[model samples]
Target chain A: MVMIPPYVPEAFLTMYLPAIYAGLIVGFIGTMAIAMKREEIHILILTDLVGLAMIFIVSAVGTDLAEALILPGLVVELAETLAISEILITREMRKIEQDPRRNLSKSSSLFPQPFSLDMEIMTTAPNFIALVLIGYGIFLTGFTGGAVAGGGIVLYALSKKARGLPVLILDGIAGVSGIAWCLWIIGFLLFFVAPQYWLLSLFLAACGLLLKVASKVGLIGLLMREDIDKE
Target chain B: MEIILIIAIALMVIGAFGIIFLKKPLDKVIMFSILDAGFVLVVVAFKYLDVAMFAALVDPLSTLVFILAIVKINEIRKNKVSGELND
Candidate 1:
């Protein structure tokens, strides 16, 4: 026979959880109230706050596993925002009767110059920053590593374009990317088919992921540059 | 509450209010980044370094997308309004 306590708090309950909950409530209510009166563009910005609220809720769980879960949710949030933004732009472009070229020329200076830096610093900063990020990313490995490395590559690509430097595309980059995909797949298969070779599989998967992610992100950067050049 | 937690909460609350109430879209974007920065701080407070790393790397890309959308929309609106005036 066991004597049960009259009241027992939940294991996961914490003081901070309440604060997070309050924040989420505030975020949601604020977004809803303001979104009702705003245009589509304004509403789109509000949606990101909703995503942040979701992150707060998830992180309130306060566990290593729960924290890991936030990464995927963040990625999904980014992807959704991107797709919606693109769709909105396309719809507006089709609905409006205007010459896009003229507008593009007028708005080419999308980012304002906030500084009067020398050209020497501008040319070297991107390279240094990208190298540091990529190196740190490689050391980290896994999803975080991929993200860091991908960001570095994107910055590098964009900086190249900003300086009017030609971004060289290697002929075999695509082929290497394809092969890396196979490596990742094979590594996954081995995890299930041959659990004993876990170490080997892990190495193969990490290497493949690094190369695959870098190549794909690099290609995206290149596409963005081309689009900007077209404009 | 811990100092870090207090700072995080402050950043987030202020950011939320600013994003909702700010008159300019650029200000809203700026507040969004501030909110994101607070979220990263929370992650750091929780000792989830890996998650924090990913979030820090990703936040700017999302902001860039927002900026791009804002710029494009504004340009489109300007052209449409001017065309209407001409007509």
Candidate 2:
């Protein structure tokens, strides 16, 4: 009779232990801040910070798994950030509607002044940098690089002024791709339950990656459309 | 490396406190950015250069989104005020 010892994930856990601890501490602090401060923007930032910490903790696996994990974590954070921002904006809009005296501008200096060339240049620079990032990411590690680059493009589009059909289209594409990325993570988790689920997980991951690419391309299409419309 | 991680963690903790205690939204945003930089440093210390790069890329985007949202909200408020005054 041959005896085989049960495999333990101890080594994996140990490697990620510090990250996990940091994530937990940050997450706790974020929650506490939200509870104590009751500020939506602070909550959003803190929660996203926690999410970023979680990415580091989760990606402490093998190099390949780490790469696979990064995108899903990022997509989750991005989606939440967008959703919360929308909610905060809507809430502020409602507040202004109810009370005209509410001085939003006086309250926050973070808001950019109306459509200055410097502001436009600042916003547009990220898109070009995203392209460069995509190029370098591809040079470094093929698909993972592509994923990060695609995310950068999405960020670029999000940072730009949201206007017209083009912005709407990009938002829709980003929302779908973000959901697909989350689904990919779910599928990846399911793969650990049974070896047979590997193919299904791979399919989900591929779809997620394709959707991300589609979203990035959608941003480009939006840009071209804007140019033509301006002409 | 461990020392670097400790420093990063300490920075994050301080940022967290700042976020909770800061009076203004803009101040909180700045604190959040600092916390983000700390997270990136920790990832770099962990030798996950790719993840670190991704963090660096994403951080500015998140900040920009927040700023845009704030700007949009302010625009809506100003427009509404002007509309009311005209009425």
Candidate 3:
């Protein structure tokens, strides 16, 4: 397997890996930090192991870690895990244990957005025929719709989070994606969408964990501050 | 071939829909973990061990993060709720 493709986007590694590493570190620190620390520690250790394995996986493959022929299963599994945990946490919080009932049953009334279907169909288009054409086009004369889409997604995310520090970070990501693609737009380029799924995915997860840490560090204060400074 | 794929597809669909319908972010995260498990299971059955392993491990870890995130976000919301109440 070709390990490192030439011209790996700077931002691809920069924005992504750091975030993942952060998550691992957080898991370690978290495992140590708990009072009910015995049983919970194993889960954190599992998280750390999984994070490390991901790093190895990314180094092995140079293509879509999220959607490689080998990737979707991981994505779906990850999604499901999140679902189950989400429920457990919801119940553990000891508030409203059940989901709120909605009077209307159809997808239409629930979402209330008139155009979600349209948006879903449109988003899938990139994964459709255009993807094949674009991939071939990039292969033939070095035209990259993938990079464009990647950058576009980042930009779209920035717009979606227009008013926060996350927006700044998102914009930074989009900017990097743009710079990464600049060559693909003009000349032959090598992309390192790594194969070490465990490694990179773990890294991303780890880094994102800082957001959790920051939240925790200030949590008590935030609670107190909320009451005192209620505006 | 068809039967297995169908099962995987069904899990993915149901899990996907279930997660979205959840009001609590934490619940959403849990449903997503289930979805991830079902998908990973399918991948293994299809003989994609490497992918399945990654799914098996990483998916649940991701859930941990999501749970943490939702907890944090919920904290923020509750803080805000209390603030609103105090006001």
Top-lDDT structure, candidate number = 1
User: Can you give the lDDT of residue A114 in candidate 2?
Assistant: 46
lDDT of 2 at A147: 58
Q: What are the RMSDs of all candidates, in order?
A: 7.0, 8.7, 22.1
TM-score of chain A of 2: 0.52
* Tens digits of per-residue lDDT for model 2, B3-87: 8988899989988999999897778889999899899988898799977877887787667656655555656578768766776
Best by TM-score: 1
lDDT of 2 by residue, A1-231 (tens): 533234535465456557667877877776777778766687777786678667766765535667678877776676678678879977877776676665544433333334322246345576676776666654543346545566556555544555576566657777987897786677778788776879887676666665555565446535532432221
Candidate 2 wrong stretches, greater than 4 Å: A1-5, A11-124, A136-147, A156-208, A211-213, A216-231, B85-87
Per-residue lDDT, model 3, residue A32, is 52
Q: How well is candidate 2 docked (DockQ)?
A: 0.14
The chain A TM-scores for the candidates, taken one by one, are: 0.70, 0.52, 0.23
